[model samples]
Target: MTLQLERDAVLRRHIGPVALAAAVINGVVGAGIFTLPAAMARAAGAWAPLSYLVCAIAMSFVVVCFAEAGSRLPTSGGVYGTVAFAFGPAAGFVCGMLTWMASVLACGGIAGALADTVGTVLPGIAAGPGRALVIIVSIGAIAFVNMRGVREAAWMVTAATLVKLVPLLLFVAVGAVMVLSGSVPPPRPITAPHVFGLATAVLLGVFAFSGMETPLAASGEVANGNRTVPRALFGAMGFVLVLYVAIQLVAQSLLGASLGGQAAPLAAAAARIGPVARMLLVVGAALSMLGWIGSDILGAPRILFAFARDGLLPRVLGRAHRRTHAPDAAIVVHAVIAAGLALSGSFTGLVVASTLNTAGLYFLGCGAAWVLHRRRIQTVGEPVDFRLLPVAAAGGMVAMAVLIYVAPPAEILGLVGVLAASIALYGIMRGIGGRARPPVG
Candidate 1:
């Protein structure tokens, strides 16, 4: 029931760098991006992009750390694997809990958002059982797709990523044309930056970029993960950063001072383009949610598999389907958990702590990268690029700490509660290790 446990079944490595990048894009650009322009405008006004830039700067450090760790230790569980490698089983267990909980909670919240999007169109599924049904059907569908095979799941993620990006790019393209011409007034220059508001905006931007880590959870299913991880991280992040900045600039230019007030800022901007464009945004938003859910299902369950493989959870979860080579049991359980959270209405309340959990994982990941470099450890895969590893690791940790420090006290307490529970669960896992350790296949 330890790391030395026999693996009777194994995951297939079908995910290449391109598929991984698509998963990263799908993860980062979800339902939030459609409305994020308005939220950023509210916080930082004309200087919203500056906040994005700051967030990107901070995230780049963290991403580099992940790239390094992923290259050196291309295993399942993403940051959890890295932490366990750098630290120990105890710390690794906590990291796994944090990572899995964050993804599952976010999945529930996004499932709710998807139902809301459906409600906008049908209005019947706006609340109650209708909303619950949407959550179940959506997450259930994604889970099924993931259970089929990694290749099929990767294709779904890639398709969803492309579909979701079209409307946003269209919005940016139309807005850009209007701005370049005389159709829309140019964005007003900000005479002064709002420091506190900008800080808040950066926090929001960080959350928008949070899902990138989730995709790494399936590292074991990735081909040449050492090379794929860094390539996907850099490629997808660059695309997202440019796309986000453009969308924000265009929305600000089109809406001007009125940007922050609109609930659906992208739709509002699209409306100015025409009804067709606006409709596209509506459809795109729903697709975006689906894409994110697909990516979450495709990757997050691997965390459960990783946990079980290490004897921290039921070993049945570590088993892959004989034919499909997919973690079917883990995928189903993760989906069930998310569906329950979505129905219980607690996911919304817990989202702040979910973000905090992600930030904490990133901090630990940065530390792991630092430790790996310090000890010159190469547990698996190819050697990672160590250039700027120390400086990047420090900056990443600081960035995560800033996010953690800025979080509400209640959410901080909630994070602590999760950690404490994880510790207790780890003890229980150890106590019943024999019972939990089932045959892998």
Candidate 2:
């Protein structure tokens, strides 16, 4: 009984709606927004904003599915818990491993981006040992804070989210003024329809929206997981959709045909505003990347903790710090892997690998929702309609299929390798007495 109580105390429910919303925002709005504009503009030309809108609309379906599943399980593992409840331990283990891999890779990519941003402002730290040190130090700082406690980590994430948004808000305001005053030039006419370009734009836009489910991973730490998770998910999605589309439009209006050529389109757009705006943008981009890393650090370890508790991973990772009530072991392990990747300077490859894993997770998560709905399982939160749940699931499945179809060949090969390895590992574990099953809530 004492052990049970101790275990219960290890993960306290301290996160409220506001902090949850902030985490959701931080997870969804990262450095991708600042960098993807040029690539998107090149892909869809003047129609890039349209692609953002379309992708957001499509992603809403997946968000709904996540909302329903998260509400029902309201556990630390996010999709892993939901999938396990519907499927079995093996399936859940696969989902958890995939989610963990994607998140760690994403954290590494953000660390690299943070290093680049620092390098931009201070050329002295642009490459070599300086860059490596920045990556290591930044990831170490985030991991330390997360090990302190969930509340502390959530508050830090909240502050970072607000700080990161300041420059983006400024850009939107200035862009609005320019548009209203007719100071911004009109977009160039498309000489011909570009189907391939639109497809590429859609893929990039979908990838940008990948972090929507991040906050759900920490639902166990939330005060009102059922209601809060769904509300925060929708709210964050709506907020980011407006912010992304506005930025795309502003970039197009300010740079026009020149938007596609510049390496940093948002920074280029800010240059038109003045040196102060440009400086603020540089700072904002750095903070946004940091916030992404912070959010991932806080959430991803919880999935590991869940996996450990369920016998999929080493039981040591399931333990939390006695005083801080943080998943210390899992956080340290995750940070080590992420730091290694960051130090290797494989940001683009990590991003691609994560994207591929995320596609599989989305499909499995949505399918889990369908299985739960069919079983008529009792859920904790606002009840979803029977008919609507399957529709949401179907939408998510189709979206994931499209994403997987468009994925680069390298990512596909990496994903296959990871799956094969996971299967072998699962078999070896099962050969031992490692299949201690936990009851699905």
Candidate 3:
């Protein structure tokens, strides 16, 4: 059934620039950044900061490529929509589902992290059944806020984004002051930078900053989409990238050798800021994870909704909530799947397994850019940011290659399974499509 959802549902313009920025910011500062610096330090030794810089440079390519595609096509499902149009419905469905699963699992990870952070501060509160219950409650509340629709969710994210940013700012500012004044504790200088280790360190750094392209996933929901999508993609990512590097630099300077082993890098840096600020880091880390969860709640369902709308899955899930205008069923599916994985302690394993499919979609997006450019030529219309896209495409190719070689094998395996399921689903869809008649009574 080619279910025709309200044009309002399919072509909604519920987002503005502020909401867009929060979504972008929300995507970037999740649990990865909270813990990655220490591991990166271990990998690169003193050169870890430089490693983060490398990842940032690599990500610029993804942002640029995604921006070009987002502005031109302006659809939900981020890379999935771009790939589908470039290829076919089945390709798009597979791509969308992969991305949806990734975002959902990522959210669960953030929920787990947020709960852990809570324990760090309110030791008793974060333990056992109490902490687990809090995680569920926090996730459920945030998910509900997101389901309330764009305007409401955007406001909450914006506030939460600000809440998360404060501690990061203090980390950088206070670290600098401590070093300049000679108050930073005397420590060993693993300070010397190593190139190869730095590269690996920065790959993890890039993971922290990877949320920028997410705005493209909900392109269909933004007002003045063609213009707004690029603005949000480039503007939000560029700002966040700078802030992330700044945060790391500040953190390293403040904590020195001692900092290299910290689980909560910002919190460690905060200790240098003074005892008062240490408490704030826990608040900020918790907020950052919550922000990530909120963005996941907002973005993932759209991909599933896209899949259902296109007849690749059950059409019942294609329906939008009559009042809220949200994809109610898709939201339920995402929440349930993420929760299942979370309770099973399987989110990390899934990340390992889904890496291949995620990387596959990046190449698929680059291929779409090529196809879109060619189609534009055949029609003889003005080229759609044709000049800038090649750079993004090339960057995506390099990034995907690196991720495939470097990402855990289990992630690649999980991706293979998802792809296989998609192929099977496509065959079933094709059979259904063939037997279908023209739309009639």
Off by over 4 Å in 2: 1-19, 147-152, 182-197, 221-228, 257-264, 315-329, 343-349
What are the root-mean-square deviations of the candidates from the true structure over C-alphas? 4.4, 4.1, 4.8
**What number of backbone clashes does candidate 2 have, counting pairs of residues 3 or more apart or in separate chains?**
0
1 or 2, greater by lDDT: 1
What are the per-residue Cα lDDT tens digits for candidate 1 across 181-279?
978655454334477777667777887888877778777778877688889999999999999999998888787887787656787777777888878
Q: Tell me which of candidates 1 and 3 scores higher on lDDT.
A: 1
Q: What is the C-alpha lDDT of each candidate?
A: 0.79, 0.77, 0.66
Model 2 TM-score (2 dp): 0.86
Query: What residue runs in model 3 are displaced by over 4 Å at the alpha carbon?
Result: 1-22, 125-130, 144-155, 190-203, 221-228, 319-326, 343-357, 377-388, 430-441
lDDT of 2 at 53: 88
Report the lDDT tens digits of candidate 3 across residue range 1-441.
Answer: 112213226466789877887677766766556655656666677677666677667767777767666666665556666676677766766666667666776666667656666776777865678667867788778768767776787777767777776777777777778777888665565555455555446445655666554666666677766567767777787777777667666766776676666656677677767888888887777777777677677777776776667666688778887888988788778877776665555323434333345566666777776666555521111224747667677877788778666765556566677789877986796677553211111
What is candidate 2's lDDT per residue for 260-293, written digit by digit as tens?
A: 7764567778877777887888888877777778
Highest TM-score, which number?
2
Report the CA-based lDDT of candidate 3 relative to the real structure: 0.66
Candidate 1 — which residues are off by over 4 angstroms?
Answer: 1-16, 123-133, 144-158, 185-197, 221-228, 314-333, 343-351, 379-382, 434-441
